[model samples]
Target: MNDKNTTQFNHENVKVGEETSPTLLRFFRRKWLGIWQSNPPGMGLFVFGLCIAVIMAIPIVYVIWRSLFAGIDRWQRLLDERIPQLLWNTLSLAGAVTVSTMIIGVSLAWIVIRTDIPGKKAWRWLLAMPLTVPPYVGAVTYIIVFGRSGWARDLWQSTPWLVNALGDYSINIYSFGGVFLVLTMFTYPYVYLIASASLRKMNRNYEEAAYSQGMSTSEVFWKVNLPLLRPAIGAGGILVSLYVLGDFGTIAMLRYVTFTAAIYFQRASFDTASAAVLSLVLILLTVAILWIESKTRRKNKYYQTSNTYRKPLTLKLGKWKPFVLFYVSVVFFVSVILPIGVLVYWSRIGIRMGALDGRFFGFAINSLKVSGFAALLCMLFSMPIIYLKGRYPSLITKVIEKLSYAGYALPGVIVALGFVFIFNNHLPRLYGTFYIVALAFVVRFLPQAMQAGEASLSLISPRIDEAARSLGYPPWKVMLKVILPNMLPGVLAGGALVFVSAIKELPATLMLRPPNFDTLAVRVYFEASESIYHLAAPAALLIVLVSVVPLRYMLKKY
Candidate 1:
């Protein structure tokens, strides 16, 4: 009886252990997961962010899979024939642009930011204002003014005195070299803006210390300041590279055979399978560039100072200031002022002809719709990752951050192509809609939103929320009452940036626009292509004007 009772108790204890084991597991899960979950506010923010990220990522995966797997045999054939050529052409342009933008942008940034250039204040804003002019629009200006049948070329041809003195081949504005020149002009601002911002905010005490140790001024700047600004330069360079890689307007207009151009051709040729495949390959190349940027940036990490200081040390350029001023003037003239003059001249021509009156209202209204929606949607999507990384900050968070950023480096063509593949087959209801294009824009540009929100929220202290808890406020209420007021400005700034970029966007807008719909960007492109140059002017000018606001804001930040 005793033995039997002991056996029965042992068996009962084993069953009890099994049942209690789950209870313990549940308790542990709730405890650990609560770190992420109990902040119902943050979790809600994260879920909101994740939906945006997943939406953004969907096109990329779809494009890759459809292009690669839909017709494996066809992609294989192209892989052997056209892919290599397309890849090389695309990468070569990206590489060349990257190197050129770095050199020009760094020089321009250093001169304007660190030295005592004449008109630094106005020039600073003016220099960055060129970004307001879309590369395609710039290309259009360069073409109509200087092409073989161009007004300038025609005048030069007619002027016998100057024509005899100067050869006809003085300006070949429609060539590979021309594309590079135009791209470098607009793209350098990306680097310049960021580098200049870094330079201004940087404490000059480090350089002063180097000078005090017997280093020359130049040596101190080169050795101390430049090295310190490596991360800044790297960050700026990455932005330039991404722009060059993804830009289709300038390349397409210049007749350059970039991957973006090639993919567009593939899509138009009723060879979407090929387009999808090429887009996948192109995205992979962008991924490689991003990886390189990440590795290079790791070598130099400079964070904002814990304490602020005034009293910037000014090393007199003395003899070089005039030279610097002249150089900057030429760059500013060619890239910024000259382009605006061209557009203004064209706009006046259009107004005098009474051409811009009829569709102006409709076009402007349509532009606002697209730009506003894109900005709102992109911000909505970016909020999750921004909050997650801002609050939780773990390896998982980092992975999610990196994943979300991957779509950013991708060319808009790849993103568009991905959408084209997915929408054409699976979601037939979305096959031809403005929302589809907006979704692509969100995916292609989520990082901009994330960066903005992340910068804004990361500045807020977690203690604010903890303090709210101490006062017995609910997590959601604390967030709504305390954190949101602080975060709103940043989120709006980011969304505004997205709004500006979407307004000026070219290729995706061109490819994905609903039939009969016309945004300013598209209006300018088609009208310009058809050589209704004057008709495209008001739209072009408006694009520049609209884009100017964010460009100014970004210039200040950089």
Candidate 2:
């Protein structure tokens, strides 16, 4: 070994390689930087970081320029009038949805992860399956099931007290309360995914230690489990907040306008300038959330970091099993079974009448093709970004890693507006094409692929790639021959998620599609809008079915 290689790493009461003086370390650090400077991958990473900065900054610049040059007067007036109401509505909805999703998701995750819930496998699959069904599809079912012409309304029309609550209660399914209920019901999967992941990975010693102190199960959970689970829970909450901030379909279907819908409205009303101004405000709100997440997410290990790992102790509920089952059943009935049932019933009726609705089918085909292409495209784009971040981590690459957030928090309408502005002006020929729709999908979902890729890459040691290189493999050859196989599972999971999401995307597709183009999500929206839900139901069911298969696989890995 070289004399300098004797530099030491010391542990408690244990001496490792020899310690180095400060001057020697500074020299090595400089040498490392020189090495980084010479490496092609490192330099390529720098260019990638710069490209991400430029791409993300495009909308920010567009929004600011439009607000300054176009919306100066209009924005000033709206800032004084409608802005506060919008803020209250949007933030209040976010708060409520976040809290509610937490309760539902956390509760179920705890039950499955820590308790002897007998049907664990089925429940896991069922809980995750809801993610594939777009919230607007659920909104459609809720409206039909509880609205004026609904079964419950008709059944309760006789009893006076029941009639009062049920009749005047048409549930409108298109109000603030309706938005909250539908969004919360669909989105609990966010919390469920992360929390359950952490819960599954946790070493059992912590819970056992708490119980050894004579604490009851609930006490152990509250005092020990939840606090430890905070980081994972917080990550999920960050995802939920970003998602809710960007959501447009269900909320708009429910007739509630957050920044997303407001932006879409402005665009629809031919007010691209004002829409861009609103997009800036939306970005500001998202940055605030991102800042908060950064402050709170201190670096800490959440994996199985100790040798004490074991299965979590399950709580025996005895008679309380009935209550838990009832609660879970009710949740499933409303969120999953009912909506799916409605779709099945409607679809059967349509089949009997031979009402396939060519337009709806056409839209479904378009949705599948676009989302499929986008999923493939996003995986290709994200692989390089993720690999560079993991192996060549640095401040600039870190910033590029964060740049994905700009798209993450952008509402569909805002994404649509950015493309509308850019493509319409800079590349007119590319305007209103499926490619633009795919690009929007990639922007919205690339972070997902990165997260998965990062985790997958972490499990694989760097030596594998080095070994390949030593064997005369070029860098690209090493990635393809060594890295690709290891990362395939994660890349596929993330791509499946992206595919599921792209199929359900509405506002972006709506604003960006060329005339006569349709996707499954668009078909459901338009068909539902015209009170022709029968034609839309089969497509909605198809979306959910396609999504569930992949979701189960994604959840299983965790």
Candidate 3:
């Protein structure tokens, strides 16, 4: 009896162990899986997304890493001789331009959106048209009009009265003042577009309340409306400042020496170490400006919570109508009409002189080839990132999203510099190839695609993703089949934006292009530098026309 009972007990124990074994195995698997495995994104999708982010970030990371080992001697030399002057030039220009743009942008937005400006609808789009003209192109026009041998100088010399009044045309187009003016004119549109949108949506309840408290119209504007517009001003100011900081072509064309110009020259001289050092400083400066903007933005948060919101009443300009109209017309003329007119005139002259030759077609083809390829790459690369971020909400996805924007924020020169270091060492096969230029563009503009894709994806319901999964689709497959089809329009719009930007991109293209390869931007920069305005004008006009694609998108968006 004892032997039989002991055998039966052992048999029961074995059965219990078998029953609990699967449970223990599952528990260990769950712990091992953690957040990623528990999520919708499988291991394959996660790895793919991470790889894309790493690739996007390689240029910036490589630049920073190279800068650290640039040697104490190189660092000291740049610090002692080059950096201080570059900082002053860059920061001063950025500051002056940002403040000017904010003032101009906000004032114009207020006039158009709030007051009874004549033909407000016409003025609205007209004022924003300067954005269609790249600042570098605008610089070229200004140089043609105001340079020493330009039309202005010719007119001044011909007219004794004008020469007597202005003292031999004392204004230098290459001076600090000229750069500030050019940047401010072209970039104020950023503030104007955003502020106008903000003004249109702003609840009039605050202004009405201020009036009810016996405040005058001016008082209400000062005490209430201006305070509300801080966010818009900050947003626009940051854009202008960032543009000024990263701007290479305009500054270089105007003969100003900022960090970007310095870095390019350093690299041109094959002093890679000094270039790295300057690039590091520029990166830090960029980080500092961004940090300041973020802190200021966080400290000031304004929200409108009203169940019964009303649009603000338009104030009649009364006796000030003509003055307001004149101001608006002047801005439109200088910003849009003048630049376009200059291009047309010179282009007409050029067309007669065979400016659109076989070489011009080659340049056009080259631009389209590289820019189109880059746009396609951006569209493809951005999908995985936006999908992973939107579908799988986690620390990892958030990081991947941020990493994609690294190139967009840094200067193109720094980006190109990073590419130089990377290709010279690890990517020699791609060095000096047009593929490298396109890749640089992708690194620089992928964020644009991700942004547009995210906006469209937000409108999509997550249940669709779940439904697709229920049909046995994996995460990657679901994004490919369902999400992409839904977001194709936004993706294309983003691609259009990337295409326009890549075409206008000068610094990176100049640095990365292989020998005997030139795009329209490169052509414009070179032709303009050499005063071959006939050749430059045709390309400049083409670029300006291409830039209209983004302006239309901005109008629809803002």
- Give all candidates' CA lDDT scores: 0.79, 0.79, 0.92
Q: Give the TM-score of candidate 2.
A: 0.87
Give the range where candidate 3 is weakest over 10 consecutive residues by summed lDDT: 31-40
Q: By lDDT, is 1 or 3 better?
A: 3
lDDT string, candidate 2, 345-422, tens digits: 999997887767676567778988999998998787777677777766666567777776567666777777888898
lDDT of 1 at 65: 72
> Quick one: best lDDT, which candidate?
3
Residue ranges of candidate 2 with Cα displaced over 4 Å:
1-53, 158-161, 164-170, 299-305, 467-474, 480-482, 485-489
Per-residue alpha-carbon lDDT of model 1 for 1-558, expressed as tens digits?
Answer: 999999999999999999999999999878767755544344555565566556767878778777657586887787899888877777777778878888888888777776777777777787787788889999888888777788788898888988778877477776778888888888888888877877787786676678789998778878877887788778878888788878898888777787889889888897887787778777787788878988888866766453765545655679988788888889888887777787888889988998667586687787788778888887766766776677666666677787787667787778777777788888889878888878777876778888888788978999987898799876546656877788998888889888888888878877887886788888888888887888888899888888877876675565
- Candidate 3 lDDT over 1-558, as tens digits, reads 999999999999999999899889988778655755576587778888899889889988988898899899888887898899999999999999999898889989999999888889988899999998889999999999999899888888999988788788776999899898899999999999999999998898898889899999999988888888889889888888888999999998999999999999999999988898899999999999999999999999898976888988899999999988898889888889988999999999999999999999999999999999999999999999999988898778889988889999999999999999999999799999999999999989999888888899999999999999999999888999999999999999999999999999999999999998999999999999999998999999999999999999889999
On the 0 to 100 scale, the lDDT of residue 459 in model 3 is: 96
Query: How should the candidates be ordered by TM-score, best one leading?
Result: 3, 1, 2
Worst 10 residues of 1 by lDDT: 35-44
Clashing pairs in 1: 49-384, 197-558
TM-score of each: 0.89, 0.87, 0.94
